[model samples]
Target: MSPTLRSIVCGVLGLTLSAAGSTAAAAATTIAGEAAPACVQYTAGWRYTFVSNGCDTVQQVTVEYRDGTAVPCRTAAPGETVTFPGYGTSGNEVLGVVLCGTTPA
Candidate 1:
């Protein structure tokens, strides 16, 4: 093949491969079937709230408050628990615990 034609072909092939690899990675992140229920637990106290990870794997969690604010994501190992202070007057109150992605802060 001519030099120019060969270079163009190689470039096209490289782009195709890169696109396919990225598509596969994106698909892998999507849940294929019913997602497993979150295994996180929480307890609200007067001054703080306790969040626990009951799953067998490490999990990232955020404490959601009744005021629609949430704490920064925290990582917890299996059977580990973490604490976050209550928010405003009337002790804001913990509304729920939510699973978070492993993205770095």
Candidate 2:
């Protein structure tokens, strides 16, 4: 083939390969799933509301504190609310909550 035609074919092939690679990369990087549990902040602490969403009632919920301590899991019925009090000074505490029997993400 002529050099010009060869260059054009190579350029088109490169573009096509790059486009396909990018499409696959985009799909692999995408992160989409069901919504997370609803939570609200109150004066003393945080409240998490669990929904069954056609699943079993929330049997337990856990609260993890900033200092690597976690409160004992407590039973929470479907559509029930659980609270975790704030720690540390006015606004420096961190709390982590996880719900059992929750709908998967």
Candidate 2 all-Cα RMSD: 14.8
Write one digit per residue (lDDT tens) for candidate 2, span 1-105.
999999999999999999898766544543333333554222333333222222244445554455753343445555555555456453444444444332322
Q: Compose the digit string of candidate 1's lDDT tens values, residues 1-105.
A: 999999999999999999898766544443222222468788788677788888999876766677765355667899998887765567577767766653321
* TM-score against native, each model: 0.56, 0.36
Total clashing pairs in model 2: 0
How many clashes show up per model?
0, 0
TM-score between candidate 2 and the true structure: 0.36
| lDDT values for all models | 0.69, 0.48
Window of ten residues with lowest summed lDDT in model 2: 46-55
